[model samples]
Target: MGEIWIIGATGRAGRNISAGLRAGGHRIVLVGRNAQRLAEAAATIEASGGVPPRTLVTDDPLAEIAAGRPDVVVNTVGPFGTTTVPTAQACVVAGSHYVDLANEFQPVRSLLEMDSAARAAGSTLVTGAGFGTLANEALVYELCAGRPSPIRVRVAAMPVVDGLGPAVLASVVDAAATGGLIYRDGRLVRTRLGAHLRRIPLPDGTTRATVAVPTGELEAALRGSGAGDVIATSSEVPTGRMARAALPIVGAILRVEALRRTVIRLIDRWQLTPPATPGEVSWAYASAEWEGGETRQAWLQTGEGYAFTSRVAAMVAARLAEGDARPGAFTPGALFGADLARSAGATITLDSTTKDLR
Candidate 1:
């Protein structure tokens, strides 16, 4: 097994992914800002009967990564809106395959913009190695492939299993910073995050307000999957009486920079974003509407959130590193075929609602 570096190792997703890889007998080099945290993550893996991976602590990120030269690097960094290109740049120079749980689209666009350099370095760059884009688009493709129709992909996140944590909060902040982007006019388009609230019915026969969040990988997926339109979102409907009353006020609070800062600071101070006990949750689905043909959909639901996505990314990285796969810049959606995406254990729902073209 070659040296595999796990950046942001202390992160929930990182630790979980690293643990899974270690258990699979791969050598891991854990990297993180906090030495103590990295040690704990390594120990946790070891305690779980996994091979304890080597660890590295760094205050200066890119330089440290440059010196490591691992076979592959799995990035668990969040809020990709504020990106440091050197991280990806150095990985390419180091001849390391790059994978990231990048939920934000702008940085991914920027990273893909470096196709020339990445290919020149003979490095593989795969982003949205997480649940956000790859799983969604992959499943959608599985359902709608070979069927001709303008499709719409929509996702509603339920706070269960791993629940929403700070990383998710950071993701929200990143989306806010960039407003939102969607597939419109047969191209990528931007809109406000809180704008365009639409009510979507859940499986439980209840409805919720869904708002677009661009920090997700949906736009890149729209282009990648060749879908007419793709909309990624979070459920913003008030859950309870108190939440219902607080809806407008909560949006107002998030809008104020100071309030947003205070809320995030409080979460940090309390470590409120760390995942609690994970439950069965998901990041999957594809809804298709057709004019005169069968409309199809696919769904991918994981029993666990951080753990599943992490393990998936780690396995993908290992494949790319160990002569198991090819080297090139790509997204997970672009990595495998429709069948492979389904075998990856994401729940796919295929809907065929057609209007007779009589």
Candidate 2:
């Protein structure tokens, strides 16, 4: 069995990932800062018929990772803007495979910048192994493969989750603080926080209003599709008229370092409940406009977001542990293939009448 270390093991995403790994027959080591919480997590896993993962309590996760030298390390901590770089660096030094569920543009871009280092170390470093990047990135990859680069591309992530935890909320705040970004003229460019509002079409012919956001998918879609202009949106973010008008003001407040931290702390203390499950199915949509005046669109349908994330992360970890990965930083769809999501209960659909991008 492969030996896997999951940092932030006591957190919701971490626990789910741990369970998925354990179910895949991997040996898990639950790593957390809190000893008591680590033990509790282990006990819960054990009660669910999984062998109790070895519990590691540590304030210094990097030291622990270097010491343990696990075959693979999965980081579930966020706001990934703060955690991804250091953790990836540690994994590179430790010569261990690295994977994270980062969805923010900064962290995803930062981790990808470590490709050279990771390759030199003969280690695989993968970022954005979650719904935030994977579903849309995969679609874009599929659409652009065996074709010329598209002139314009748009991707939207619409997740339906039962609930969210403090970490998810914090990550959103962190992204807001970073403000909106897009790929234009073959470069990352800035935009207003709530700009580019549109009603994105779903798999079942329905539509949801989406708002421009600085998500990892923006980078992923651009890189994967070789597109010059790309915009990433999300249904989770508010897209109403009032919300759009207020975004600039709210974004301004969040841009300050101290103010951002204070807002995050206040939000954490408030412990807001995330939007309720939108529906049984979550959809990720991608549309591309080719240079020749042709356009194509597609959708990837999956179960609730958290459950899908667990599967995606586990699958990537298992692949890496089995030596099915290359030495470099990559998004899951880039490292594996567009079909990776389908293996985890995802179904893809293209417009029946038009020339589909499949």
Which candidate has the top score in TM-score?
A: 2
The estimated TM-scores of all candidates read: 0.81, 0.96
Which TM-score value belongs to model 2? 0.96
**Tens digits of per-residue lDDT for model 2 on 1-358?**
5688999999888899888888778888999889999999999889889567899889999988778788899999888998999999999999999999999989999999999999999999999998879999988977787989988889999999988887788888888888889888898888999899888866576889899999999999989988888999999988889989998888889899998898778877897546666689899999888866788887899999988998899899988988897998999998999899999889887652344332
Model 2's lDDT to the true fold?
A: 0.88
Predicted candidate 1 versus true structure: per-residue lDDT over 146-207, tens digit per residue:
75645455544432344555665665554555655677646778665454455554444555
Cα-based lDDT for every prediction: 0.64, 0.88
Worst 10 contiguous positions by lDDT, candidate 2: 349-358
- Give the runs in model 2 whose Cα sits over 4 Å from its true position: 269-273, 352-358
Model 1 TM: 0.81
**What's the residue-level lDDT of 109 in candidate 2?**
92
lDDT (C-alpha) at residue 143 in model 2: 77
Error of 2 at 291 (Å): 1.5
Clashes of each: 15, 0
